[model samples]
Target chain A: AQSVAQPEDQVNVAEGNPLTVKCTYSVSGNPYLFWYVQYPNRGLQFLLKYITGDNLVKGSYGFEAEFNKSQTSFHLKKPSALVSDSALYFCAVRDRTNQAGTALIFGKGTTLSVSS
Target chain B: GAGVSQSPSNKVTEKGKDVELRCDPISGHTALYWYRQRLGQGLEFLIYFQGNSAPDKSGLPSDRFSAERTGESVSTLTIQRTQQEDSAVYLCASSLLLAGGRDTQYFGPGTRLTVL
Candidate 1:
């Protein structure tokens, strides 16, 4: 079984300050992790994905995620949070061990509020 | 190039009625997927088509849910005997299938379904 957990229901951060949204996962084998953002009235947009290699993967809108094997965590981070960054964030995972008939499983989602 | 798109941006229907949601994947992309987004829950994988062949429909909630694609271009997801619980936002996504693993799924604005 594969699952993702987003610990926070909402994360409040001050604008121009660093921000982090937590995520953890449970999977049978190595995981293909991804981060996506959803704005109001819009569908999810891919931010970044961690397939292999570097632990830190950079993505669109100055977003990045670090894959920690030991902790089984892939947290989305931004150097300086912008007011526009306020949106819903989701963490998803897929078992890389099996290539066929696998769909990405996502967490409940975290609402990020960047105060100006 | 246009990204994945979905028809019927918003639909309101009475219970027991049938509804159809459409998706237009990006040109040259061979993979298309459908997901459901509940009020608080994150996106749930519903089904996916790999070049007109769906290898996985396990995520679909019930038999009332069925989907089909035409030559990897457009897809239609139909729900019969719609129930109040079926009210949700139907999201469509597409990804390049060259490597499958390396490509990210790009999502559309989605169709907001309201069951009355």
Candidate 2:
């Protein structure tokens, strides 16, 4: 079985400060990790994905995530937080072992609050 | 280009009643997916459709839940005998298939379903 875990329920950060939303996963064989953001009353937006990539993957909205295989973690990071960046973050993983008829398994999500 | 779109932005239904949700994927997208988001929780995979392949029903929670896609365009999810537990935001997403399964899914605004 494939699964994703987001340990933090919420993360608070000041504007212009670096922010990290941690995510870890368990899957059979190699994993394909993804990050998504959702604002209030809106659908989710894809941030980035790690699929047989370099350890570091850059994504939309000045966001990036590092895929750490040894740690089985893919943590989303932003160099500087913006108040507008406050939203719900989700981490998802697709099991490469099952190439067909498989959907992404998502984490419980983490709320990010960036204050001015 | 227009992104994925879902109908009935908000729906309120009574328990034991039947309800149907619709999704329109992006033009030329070969893959479509449906997900459910409960309050303060992560997105749950519901169903997936890719090209002409048999749809993946593995994610559907129960027999009461069923979905169908017409060709590679529109999809409808029907819930028979809806329950309060079925009250959640139903989201639809579409993705262009890429080699090595590196597709990025674009989501719709979602239909907020509330079962009374």
Docking class of 2: medium
For residue B2, give model 2's deviation from the true position in Å. Answer: 0.6
Best by lDDT: 2
Candidate 1 chain B worst ten-residue window by lDDT = B95-104
List of clashing residue pairs for candidate 1: none
- The value of fnat for model 1 is 0.56
RMSD of 1: 1.2
Task: Name the regions of candidate 1 deviating beyond 4 angstroms.
Answer: B98-100
lDDT by residue (tens digit), candidate 2, A1-116: 78899999999999999999999999978988899999999998999999885999999999999999999999999999999999999999988766643578899999999999
State how far residue A29 of model 2 sits from its true place (Å).
0.7
TM-score of candidate 1 relative to the true fold: 0.97
The alpha-carbon deviation from the true structure for residue A111 of candidate 2, after best TM-score superposition, in angstroms, is 0.2
- When only the first chain is scored, the TM-scores of the models are 0.98, 0.97
- What TM-score would every model get versus the actual structure? 0.97, 0.97
